[model samples]
Target: MSRRLFSCFGKASSNPNHDDKATTTADLTTEEQRRCGPVVVELFSSQGCATSSEAELLFSRLGRGDFKLDVPLILLAYHVDYWDYMGWKDPFGSSQWTVRQKAYVEALNLDTMFTPQIVVQGRAQCMGNETEEILSCVASAPRVPAPTFQATFQKPTPESLQVSFTGALRTKVDQEGVSVMVALYECGLVTNCPNGVNKDKVLANDYVVRRLEKICSVKDISAKKTLSGTVNFPLWESFNPAKCGIAVFVENSSRQIFGSQNFQLPDNI
Candidate 1:
């Protein structure tokens, strides 16, 4: 029995042309299905904001094999550009994401906007700076039937890598206003504080939202939708393996998060 899921739209304001429906890729043999997995956790943050630093710290602490299951918490740090005028332009900031945040504000019916907002499961939002709240949210979170998402990371030479993911819809969903988003993040970013809030304190950040790319939308899921895309990373700077991983998730017909996951590829093929 096939159920219909209404399509949802993204909160971003630029209104980038999106498919909003299912897409197709080369046929995947049965073997391809074995390695896919869990939902994702997204954090909307900014580099120049002090509050966001706290949240980044929390994510760093949690990603340290502290959770019950070895299940790594998949995270995508969406660098927002609204706070750039405050001084210190975030190398990773994107104005388009700021537009998306506005849409979320309207959707959540909030009084105002702020930094360090954590979007969990695409249905809920919490302040990233609150450790207790984040812990509670993750502990009691609902379990979703694992979806099929395959990602491949390749380093053709050195100092550069390419990551790709293909997400398949598990249940039939009404493709009315939803969009499929493929987000990219960097791990193990350390900075010698100079001008920001934590001056002189060398801060470490993991699960950082370095970049965001909206691949398509739920409107494309009309019995023929598949989520797939790729993002490239440059390794010119120093990074840590323990603190690095790739994350991806899907938003529903109303721009609410529906699913997500994080992955750190194994070293030996």
Candidate 2:
């Protein structure tokens, strides 16, 4: 249901039983000077949506390399809070994610926002559960050199974790209002839904966004662009470094992503 149930309207695949249909072929390559990075696939989902389980499952497969994709993928799932009022209060849900999704809604010129939506490189979108369409979007998205960054982790306090990163852009980049967005994500999560649309269900989620921070602003990322910044994340109960990781990407004013990279958090952190 829409946050404003009466006024908000959106489109979704009427066919939830998405099949393993073949997808449109794509060939993406770059000059040797600057090779392309992995595709950044962002899924807007909620644990409260009954229909989101399928999409979540598919995302797990994509993250775990269950599919033989030509290009690599850096997957992230943002759980929005609008569905909370329906019954189940999703522990992962947040209004910040809702704002982020709305930004995509405006950028894509969509009628409204919808759950189980996949935005590829911030350029193309499709129903999240539609396997073929999702792969097609990934295949066709424009490519760019992967963003490069080095994460430095500091000793953590009981309540929060602080980390810093230094990055460089070695190739031609032509985007304004560029920002570095860092996300702390988790995998292999299982939740027992006790209320609402997903009542009495055991749901699994991966690449779930636990924290998102736009760490720095760079007016011009072309040429030898260099930047460094730090972000602090509040710790959650039962947090395990082994299950968490970081994803870094570059995005422009239009919210179109150019490249992304993922780094695993050290177990000793």
Highest TM-score among the candidates is held by which one? 2
- Per-candidate count of clashing residue pairs (backbone under 3 Å): 36, 0
lDDT of 2 by residue, 1-269 (tens): 45663111245532212112111113433453146667899998988777789999999999888889877889999998888887889899999998888888777767678888898888788888889889888877666678677889866687788889887844445444577898999998999998998899999999999999888877645646667899999879888889999988888766777667888888788
lDDT of 1 at 92: 65
The segments of candidate 2 whose C-alpha lies over 4 angstroms from its true place after superposition are 5-10, 13-34, 171-175
Q: What are the per-model C-alpha RMSD values against the true structure?
A: 10.2, 5.4
Overall local distance difference test of candidate 2: 0.78
For candidate 2, list the clashing residue pairs, or say none.
none
Please give, for residues 132-227, the per-residue lDDT of candidate 1 as tens digits.
666655543433434467888787657766777786756455635455565555677777756555545566676666545665655535333566
lDDT of 1: 0.58
Q: Which ten residues in a row have the lowest lDDT in candidate 1?
A: 1-10
